[model samples]
Target: MKITLFEQAAYRYLPPDFAEHHDSVCDTPYSLVTHDGMYSSMRNFLDELMFGARSGFDGIAVTEHAQSSYDLMPNPNVVAGILAYQTEQEELDVAIFPMGRSLGKTREPVRVAEEYSMLDVISGGRLVAGFPVGLSYDASLNNGIPPIDVRGRFNENLDLVLRSWQDPKPFAFNGRYSQYPQVNIWPRPLQQPPPVWLTGVGNPATMQLILKRGFGFTFFGFAGSKLTAQRIFPRFWELADEAGLEHNPYQVGFLQHIAVAETDERAEREYAEHVEYAFHTGLGAIPPQMLALPGGIDIRGVQALLRDPSDFGIYWQMRQASLRDLIDSGTVIIGSPETVADQLTDLCRQHRIGNLHALLGFGSMPRELAMRNIKLFADEVAPRLRNLWQGSGFEHHWWPERLGGTLRRNLGEKVSA
Candidate 1:
């Protein structure tokens, strides 16, 4: 399996009762932050990513979140650029992944294409580009896109981006959301076109798009792993089967919040407060209306959600959730190396996940504690799960060629069973 360390640049010094006083996104007051505290939070986040690279993680990933205390990154590509150069200089053969620039939020698609191309060139063909349709709050409230049009805009921007990278000749492009006089990008990605990935949250339409377009699918386990997995994974493979597509595990990736220690009790004792902080003050504080605006979701989707809101497990209780709530719901996996590995292995094997994005840094966790989690996960847990799909006879076409991956040029290309 391809194991990556995912880090978010969450402000680490929020007051104990920050959640009670304010929301985490859009309207949160900046006055709560000190200059040095902000710098330290961001600086330490970068340092921890590099620490993961050096500690033997296969790749290091970051995400984009704007006007949010949970993740301060307005553009994850900036972090990816720095990591690209730094990893290349240090001769670290790890992938530089940006769970990256949101297509629906951006008015500039060419710039996004240029940035990914440049990152691939700098990282020496080691970019795993992720394109999320975008969160409702970020696109609609923060960037001022119509909530109903987000998916349409995302579809158009994605096509333009792929064409910008893959088209050999300069071409004029015309589309509903955007128009270009002449379309061409310099330093067009190093791996022909770097592997493409899309992020989703149990949307059947999104799953269909990922499968139909031959792109990788990433599911973030922030809601509740056990709950989401039961409903989502089965439906994904079922769709693949209906489409006559191979059920290659590499095509599916999962991002999970994890913490590990020498023993389960010790892990709970050390990480409990931070885990509660991550949920209560971060995701838990964001109101549900902000997450899904009235026009944001399709009518069918809205109806389904109304009937079965089980997909949003633990999210309703996140604002005041305890450590037990996080663990029992499987939102955050905390335990000894053995316990963590066993659970993760079973989850991946059962769900057929070939790429594992381990979120080791979160909440108000200190740099030392985060580093220790990364080190222990790398040294103890990663090795145990690396070979889970070793003899499965499937190839990782979703990864970079510089790594052990065999790139798939198109959806029609056969993948090994």
Candidate 2:
């Protein structure tokens, strides 16, 4: 397994009763955030990502969330640019994995491609580009993209991005949502094309496309691994089997929230409320309506989700969920190093997961505790888990070439515009 550091730039100080008074995203009042608090939260987050790189993480990952009080990262690439040059200058071989610009929500698709290419070039060819369809609230509420058009836009945007990366000659493009003439970009990525990754929940259509296009499929386990793994992973492999594709574990990645300390008791004492704060004020506060607008999910997807809501895990109760509730539901794992390691091991083994995005720094977790978690996990837990899939005989095609991935070009599909 490849253990990476996943983090979010969350506002560090919110009023204790902020959750009761406001939602955490889109419309959270700026007045609730102090000027210094904003600066420190952002600065500390960047420092921590560097710390993770120096401390021996294989990669550093972050996603985009605009106009959100919890995660202030409107564009993850800005931070990625800093990481790219810093890590390169330091000669750190860690991958610059940005769950990059949301295609579905972005108006300028060419800029997105240019940004990733530049990041890869500066990082010496170590870039794992993540293209998510985008969160509903961020797309619809913040960017004014119609919910029904999000997926369609994602399809077109993704095709344009890949073509822009690998296409040798400038070409004209005509599309429903985007139109470009003489599409040529400078300083193409140093890796021919850096590895591409796509994230989704349980959307079968999304999974099918990820498989058909031959990109990495990542699943975020914020809801809770135990609650979601069985439901989502099986469906994924089933689709792969149906499509006559080998079940390469590296084709899949998972993200989970984690915290660790000297003992289980101490872990809870240190991280419980922070974890609760993450859920209650961050994800929990995102109204369900915002997650799935009227046309966000297809009719069949709606039916399937309604029939088996277990894929969502503890999200339904997150608004008022306690720390014990978060732990019990597996949404946030709080324990000793051994306990945390065991949980992660079992999770990866059971799901045949090859990429583990260990989200160590999260909502309101102070820098000291966050650093402690990163250090202790990197020391004790990551080592035991990193070798889980090494001897499994499967290749990791999804990782960046500079990081030892034997990447093949789009499964031999031609780049067309």
Candidate 3:
């Protein structure tokens, strides 16, 4: 299994009473921020990523969010550039994954292609590119995109970006959302195209798109893994089976929050408060309407959600949840090295996940505690989980080639543009 350290650059100095007076996204008061607090949040984030790289993580990942106290990064590529060059100088062979620019939110598709190509060049071909369809609020409220047109815009922008990277010569292009007299980009990716990944919640259309087009699929367990994994992952592999594709585990990636200490009791004592802070003030505090704006999810998706509502897991009750509530729901895993390793291993084995994105720093965790979590995870927990798929007769087609990822040029039938 490929285990990477993941973190959101959350402003860690929110007052303990933040959830009562403020939401985490879009309209959160900037007056609540101190210069030192903002600086420490961002500075510590970068330092911890570098620390993970040095501590032998297979990769270090960051994500993009805008107008949000939970994640300060509006553009992850800027950070990716810094890590690309820094890691190169330090000879750290880890992948620099900005998981990454959101397509539905950007008007400049070619610029996205160009920036990714540059990072691949600067990092000597160690970039794993990720493209997320913009979050509803991030696209519409934060960037002024019409919610109804977000997915349409995402499809068009993705087609343009892929062609921008792969087409050999300048070509005339006409697109529904964008058009250009001649399409060309310099510094095409060092790996033809660095392996592509898309993030999703359990959307079958998105799952079909990833499988048909030979792209990697990543699922975030912010809604709680145990509650949603059985529903989401099986449906994904069932689609692969329907398409006559082998269930190659590496094609799937999962992101989960984890905290590890010397023992389970100490871990709860140390991390319980911070874990509560992460969910209550961060994800839980974001208004539901912001996540599901009009025309964001398909009508069928919304209807299915209304019928079952199991897909959202414990999200509806997260704001007032205690540490025990979080753990019981699998929103975050906390324990000793052995306990964390055991739960993660079983989760991956049952779900057939070959890539593990371990979100080690979150909520209002202090710098020292976050660093310790990263260190302990890398040193103890990760080693136990790395060999889960060693002899599975499958190659990790979703990873960068420089990092022992084997390329499989054809995965299944291509999705129509």
Candidate 4:
């Protein structure tokens, strides 16, 4: 199994009653923040990411959100650029992953292409590009894009981006979402295309596109993997099969909230409140109506989700979710190193999850405790799970070549029976 640290730059000093009075996103209160608090939060978050890179993590990841209290990252590429330079300076061979900037939401697609290309160049080809269609709220509410046009905009913008990176000569792009009289990126990516990855939320069409276009599919499982993975992964692989693609595990990535300590009891005591804070103030606080606004989802998809909301798993009740509710439903894994290793290994092996984005830093977790958790996980848990897919006969096509990924094609031949 390949393990990496996935953290959001959540402002860590929200009051105890933050959830009772304010939502985590969109219209968060500025009265809750101090300038020092803002600087410290962002600084600490960056420092932690650098710490993860130097701590022997395979990769470091962050995502994009706007006007959110929990995750303050408006542009993930800026952070990715900083990581690129830092890791290159330290000679860390870790992938710099930006989960998404919402191609649909972006007005400047060429700038997006330039940033990733520069990141690849700076890191010497260590970039795993993630392009999510985007959340309804973030793209529409924050970026001011029409929810109905999001997917179409994403498709057109993505085409423009890929060609912008690969085309040796400048060319005109007549995209519905964007138009460029001359498209030529100065620094082409070091890798052929830097391993394009896409996020899918149980969308058969998205899954098919990931398989068909040879892009890696990443599933955050923020709702709770145990509750949603069985329904999602099987459906993903089934779609891959129907598309005549191999069931290559590397085609999939799953992110899970994880914490570790000397004992399961201790782990819970230390992490439970933070975990609760994460869900209650983060995903739980976002209004559901804002999440899937009409036209944000495909017409049929909206109907399917309405008829059977099981795809969302335990997300509906997350606002008042207890630690036990989170753990039982597998929204998080908090335990002794032994316990965490066992659970994570089983999850990867059973689900054939090639990439594991272990979320170590969550809502309001102090820097000290978060660092301790990272160290413990790196020392105890990561070592044990590193070889889960060693003989599984699968090549990791999703990782950067400089980090030991094989050629992107014919990966299915390695799948061990």
Candidate 5:
């Protein structure tokens, strides 16, 4: 299995103490916590990414969000640029920005895609493009579009971007939200088409689209269990088969929070504090009012479920049971390196999961703690997993290595070397 580390770039300063106070005292739709400073958080996150790269993570992941404490990477391309430059010097594939939240407005996404393509050329095509039909409220608010229209726009935007990347000559695209007469996108992605991964929350329609389009599927595993994944994965495979595409298990990626330490007890103790902060503060930032808007089933369901505390007991119980099962089934893959590796191996063997994307620095985990977890996971856990997968006929067709080398050679020693 190919292992990639995902960092949410959660602000390190959003401590549990501060979050508890906000829960009890704050009443506004948003809170400007002291830890929301951008520069320090970016610096720390960059440090962590670099640390991960040095420690031998196959890829470093970045994502996008807006006006929420869950993640602060509003412009993932900028982060990608930084990673490309850093990794170029080290001569390693740094799969940086997976641009998210570009639902429609071909101009912006096309421009961003063009820029990323240039970055890919500079980095020799190590870029991985992640597209998503973002949550209703944030997508609408940030893009100055309506919540209801986001999905349609998202679909159109993705089409335009893909066409722009693939088409050699200028073309015209007349969609509801975007109308472009000239579709000439310069600096075409170095990797023919840089790997495109679709981020979803188990939306059947989106999953079907992904399978039909032959794009990889990446899901957030925090909200569901192994059974949830099992339910979703088979449908994805069925859809892919129906779409007449090759059934490659590597095309499916799952994201989850992971923290490994010397022992399960220490890992749980350290991880629980951050997990609680994530639940209370990170998730708390999403106003109940915003979630009430119309959109995908998961968001709508979660919103409806959260409406009445009494009604949530069943959901909570299911969620708790699911989480325990995930832990037992080795789906979440947390705890000591030995235990985590054993579980990860079993999970891969059982589910035939090829890509494991681990969200390492979630919640308000301290920089030191986050770095320590990265080091331990890389040193102790990754080696064992690598050994297990070695000679197992798992394809190592990672995108970064293929595209990034071209960028390095073109930019010469100063920029790419």
Candidate 6:
């Protein structure tokens, strides 16, 4: 039950005159006026992560998204690299940057793995690589790859990287998107094969793959509830067992948006603004037409969910409870330190969750408020949860710190510098 701070680095914009003049042009539902600048926001994020590490959080997590108001860190690897460098300077055991999107043609997965491997070597074996089969539009647009082929490409690319990492000698891979002949990747990861975590809404095939391959499975707890997670997680285990895997409970994780304040009332008040942004602007980024298709839930469905609201509701309301009717019932966890901690602990115990990815900075949340929640969670919630799994040996690590100093030094200052 190690506590971790997860940040999406949402871009929140605010200028006095632009709001009035460009309200029409700003059709997206997620943008809002915030006083903080980009660097200031990032600094605040880093400060929260540092505070989490110092206070007792096992690790800090960051993610990638693009061309939307939902998140700002389009290049999560750059942020991960910075955190790795800083963690080295401070000699902290904090693991930063666990998850990022898959690689593209221009961006090879092996190169990304090498970078993370170097970070692991430098960090003393503290890196966890989170690989995701990215959203259709983002992957297609950014990587010049079509959406239909994204999943296959993701799987193939991961296979290639894993083989490159594990294979002691030069090998050839004739993947759909990648083909190599007798070339071994340099600077192997410190954690043997390196820990890999897969993030997604709920892809059964993906879950089966992770379980079969002995990779960690992480679900974004936005669209569903703990019960839903509990249901899906066991199925993953069942599939793994069916595949003859030695059922390890440590292989499952869940992501949630969290806000903890000095008091419940204050927490609710402060978090309301972010809730509005998440539903109004965050969901508004996707065109209504795209979501209206079969098996698709449109922007209107977002509006409807916000309007009706459910306990263990959709992902949009997974953080802020004030704006909706169902507060305590849904995936969103918001309250004072004690209250939120109780909720988190209970959720984990109920679902038998091994890892909890506490998403702190999200939905246009102010950096200051986000940092406060991080500190509060680190100081209060984490210690209590640690009692649940004393002998489990569930440790968290970041890239740079995972790799020992000698390996890092051998790789040269420039490898991770």
Badly placed stretches (over 4 Å) of model 6 are 14-36, 103-107, 224-227, 244-247, 287-322, 325-329, 391-417
lDDT of 6 by residue, 1-417 (tens): 555678766555533232223321124333453445666656766676666666666677877666545556566777777777777688877765557755532247667667777766776667777887665445655456654466566767776666667778887766667676765767887766567777755445667666655567877776545435665666677777788875444566777767788898998898877755554444433443232232233345446545654322343343233365335444467888888888878877766576788877665677677777777777777777766655655433212333321111211111001
TM of each candidate vs. truth: 0.98, 0.98, 0.98, 0.97, 0.81, 0.79
State the lDDT of candidate 5 residue by residue for 23-95, as single tens digits.
3111422445454455677778888888888888878777777656667767777777778888888887556
Candidate 2 stretches with Cα past 4 Å from truth are 411-417
Compare candidates 4 and 6 on TM-score and give the better one: 4
lDDT of each structure?
0.91, 0.89, 0.91, 0.87, 0.64, 0.61
TM-score of 1: 0.98
Q: Worst 10-residue stretch by lDDT in candidate 1? A: 408-417
Model 4 over residues 1-417: C-alpha lDDT tens digits? 678899999988888888888888888998999998899889888888998998999999998898898899889999999999999999999999998667878889899899899989999999889998888888999998999999988888788888777777999977777788999888988987788888889989888777867888999878988999999999988887787878788778999999899999999999988999999888888878878978899999999998999899888999899999999989999999999999998888888898999999888888888889899999999999899888878888889888999746332211111
Candidate 2 accuracy as lDDT: 0.89
TM-score of 2: 0.98
Instruction: After superposing candidate 3 on the true structure, give the runs of residues whose Cα lies further than 4 Å from its correct spot.
Output: 410-416
lDDT of 1 by residue, 1-417 (tens): 999999889999999989999999999999999999999999999999999999888898998899999999999999999999999999999999998899988888899999999999999999999999888999889999999988888888888888888889999978777899999899899987799999988898889888988899999989889878878889899999988999999999999999999999999999999999999889999999988987888899899999999888889988998899889989999999999999999999999999999999999999999999999999999999999999999989989999878888764321111
**lDDT digits (tens) for residues 293-331 of candidate 2:** 878888898898789888889999998998888888789
Model 5 — which ten-residue stretch has the worst lDDT?
408-417
